[model samples]
Target: MARRGGDDRTLDLLAWQPPEPQRYAEERVRTATLRDRISRAVSETLKDCEQTRADVARAMGEWLGEDVSENMLNAYASQGREEHTIPYLRLLALVQVTGDTRLLQLGAELFDTTVIENRLKPFIEIGMRFDRRNRAVAIAQEEDREIDVAIRTIRKGARQ
Candidate 1:
């Protein structure tokens, strides 16, 4: 309340209760479907080049010196089976051909990293520290506001 005497206008620190922990399902991250993540990345990479799945398949097939089929590409881009996920080599080829990193980004996200690239440069970081830091600050500010509201409520209750 105060250093030593009667004018003790403390925050009534003990009167404040900490908020309850949030439930798992109520946490920030949502459970995303792998199928959707894969399909969206593939489609966005192709779409940026004004290319269809067939065109990408043909180009990638030529680059890989193997038969990457249009139907297989379609299946991969159309949310096919779990085993239908594109390999890393194919992903690199797609990034090379389309010159976009949407798929690469999804791969980075899966491994808890971020992807940064350009025509002559590429960079991958170990962890998503920046994002986590920003989120932590946001949560702290929110909690501060909640505590302010709580203190006001207690002061009001005491007055009445």
Candidate 2:
């Protein structure tokens, strides 16, 4: 479609049709479960981290005030060891040691909640405030319509 300025290369958003919702649901089912994904995530974080597994274990142990061994880390990273999923507190310690906050975000996504970074809090707050203001405006408009209807009913009765 040509733009107002006569450029023929611009795409028109008004012509776009959204994909069917079933497509999205099927895609979700195609993905791995949360348990397997978390195992992969732990392995990936360990692989990408600058610290050695033992060093991470030691740091995590110190953070948790409990013994977190290399074997425990190994089990957490292994997909076959489903029975050995890491506990929440130990996961937090691991996150602290490796600085991989995405591990925390993975769980939050399942609940349809966001894990906001401290730096982005102000920006998110502004968006939330706008959402609240828009809802308030919609509610006020609805109340105004009801008030107008009631006033018209009373005025009509008085005239009769």
- Give each model's whole-structure lDDT: 0.66, 0.80
lDDT of 2 at 101: 73
Give lDDT tens digits, candidate 2, residues 50-108.
Answer: 99999999999999999999999999988889998889999999989988776776777
Question: What are the clashing pairs of model 1?
Answer: none
Which run of 10 residues does model 1 get worst, by summed lDDT? Answer: 20-29
Candidate with top TM-score is 2
Candidate 2 Cα errors over 4 Å, as ranges = 1-33
Query: How many clashing pairs per prediction, in order?
Result: 0, 0
Q: At residue 138, give the lDDT of candidate 1.
A: 100
lDDT of 1 at 133: 82
- Give TM per candidate: 0.49, 0.72
Per-residue error (Å), model 2, residue 3: 23
In angstroms, how far off is 116's CA in candidate 1?
A: 1.8
